[model samples]
Target: MIPPEVPLDDEELVTRAQAGDLEAYELLVARHTASAYRTAILLGAGADAEDMVQEAFVKGYRKLSRYRGDASFRSWLLAIVANETRNLHRSRDRRTGLVLRAARAAPYSEAAEDGAVDAALAGERRATLVQALRSLPERDREVIVCRYFLDLSEDETVAMLGWARGTVKSRTSRALVKLRGLLDVEELSRG
Candidate 1:
């Protein structure tokens, strides 16, 4: 008896999804959900990040026929997530708090011996960075989050933002400058 072939790559899954394979589409959603959630959080969706990710996956699956297959499936999905997040933001009349929660500590770590001190310092730094990031204008924050927080490539950012390559580059540069200024001010205020 021959073993069933597994779809090893995103392209394979995407092709299957485009051909109306529900399992393939579900697998793609499982693979990309983390990234979608992270992008939603960075976009200030806050507690609604999970919902936005879910909605993005649903929208992507529904619009699968429109996918041109020029870019990676992850990029395409993230673009949907970004758009959903923006729509959520616009619909909410009140501003949602943008908070980057501290990462959970790993179990059975040597760092646990000094974890208290280390965690305090690390949390403080993370809080400061998150605060500075949240203070920037939405466009600047989006660029910074796409470039740094999400660790997306320039091309991916362009796809996600629906911006030209040159525009992504310029926006990223300007965003970084503004972020640095915000961080510097934060530092001076602390001292």
Candidate 2:
């Protein structure tokens, strides 16, 4: 009797999908849908996040031939998600373009846990941070969200943002500094 079939990893799935295997591509979509959705929401697709994920997946499938496997499939797909989300924003008002809103639901996630008073305080803190993130320059917000909020690695962020690794490093450092300054000001105002 044949042994049960083992599940294929992303590379194998990608190879099959690139060769015209729809099932393999569907599996890839199933595996990454949540991540893609999260990336969309974090990157400010807002209420349109789901639709953006669908578009990203479709775009990813069409561009399969162009995917060079230089990055993990997740990061590669997220780059698509990011680009699609940005496009969504751009299609709206050019004057208010690329407004990177950090996901309000996440705030260094306890995901924002605590008792009644503690929870209230946590929520306020989270709101402050989210507001601060929203105020950051677009690129500054992107690196902070990718590296910290989304828990992506330095290299993964590089791939997702299509930046050199050093760019990610420097942007992250500067973003963190700016974020801290904002938080400090918020705290001072609260006191």
Candidate 3:
């Protein structure tokens, strides 16, 4: 189900977008721009990421007529973002490194802490987590990002990743295990 607070209904927005309503398209963009930006940034090609997002948005807007509405617009848009990000990396001929960077690093949260010690520790932890993520294989990293950070359900994740149900089940399990192992290392390092 679409989140109740999503500001507008998917069907209504799609209908409006189809009818050449520019504001309706803007509303869709407003609703998803953050996720698209974060996904691009996390993919670790800032310029490429921005370009990919813009391209994806344009493509998505053009293809609005084909939207089946089986998945919410957000999910469908995210799929495009993910695919475009992958394609951009491929075009640059740097898939492996970019994928690792995306998997290993996370966006630093500016508002996490204000106190000196807390802030320092949070920064360190964030960096450590990113390093650990960078160390994992691409499949593991992709799973972690889609499942945890993006807060997608199993079904949504399957759709976004274009993986089968069984693949998602097993891959999510493997990714969590790898992430935990990395976090454990962090704990040990801290102690």
Candidate 4:
């Protein structure tokens, strides 16, 4: 069964999944499929995107026994999906051009996003924003995806990336600054 405090932090579910419990694995899929699909779509489009996500889940299932519980299962799965999607983008035969693709949705806008006030222009702005994200360096893009798209905190990002806290902080900050500059340029060109 899933936990009360944390939906995705069910140790029993994870153990069962690791032990080849198909039901438990299905529960995990039900819980995280939206995010996985969104991440895949952000990384690519069409059939290759779907294939990349399917491959990630398959890969995760195969390696479930190796899970050490050092990080949350969701974190581990996100890392796997991210890696698989990135690898899929890199494979020449796939020719998905995902490496130059952008996210499918914008980060949730709160009071902090006062600059993005154009509701009628949301979709186009978001597409433009996603395109800019695709142009960033791999490390920058990964940090952004992990931190924003996956809604993982800095510590979780560090765990996923195998980097120190300071390094994650520095890299994420630098990446956001670069992304902001890209957005500014995009905004200007649109004007």
Best by TM-score: 2
> Model 4: what TM-score?
0.75
Candidate 2 lDDT over residue span 1-191, tens digit each: 99999999999999999999999999999999988988888888877889999999999999999998889999999999999988887897552212234344444346335567777777777678778887788899889889986899998999999999989999999999998999999899989
Name the regions of candidate 3 deviating beyond 4 angstroms.
Answer: 1-7, 95-114, 186-191
lDDT score of residue 178 within candidate 2: 97
Candidate 1 residue spans exceeding 4 A from truth: 1-7, 97-114
Best by lDDT: 2
In order of listing, the candidates' clash counts read 0, 0, 2, 0
Q: State the weakest 10-residue window (summed lDDT) of model 1.
A: 101-110
Give the per-residue lDDT digits (tens) of candidate 1, residues 1-191. 99998656998888898998999998998898888887887777777888999999989989999999778888889999989988887798755434453122112234434779876766666677878877777778788888887999998888888889988899899989988998899889989
lDDT of 3: 0.77
TM-score of each candidate structure, all chains considered together? 0.87, 0.90, 0.81, 0.75
- Write one digit per residue (lDDT tens) for candidate 4, span 88-186: 667754544332344333353454245555643565666776687777877887788778866788867776677788989999999999999999998
lDDT of 2: 0.86
Q: Write the per-residue lDDT of candidate 3 for residues 1-191, one digit (tens) a residue.
A: 76678566767988899899989998888878888877766655565777878888999998998988877777788888888887876777754433334534554466555677777777777777777877788777777778877788887878778889899999889888888998898889789
What are the Cα lDDT values of the candidates?
0.81, 0.86, 0.77, 0.72
lDDT of 1 at 38: 78
**Worst lDDT window (10 residues) for model 3?**
95-104
Per-residue lDDT value at 98 in model 3: 31
Q: Compute the lDDT of residue 38 as modeled in candidate 2.
A: 86
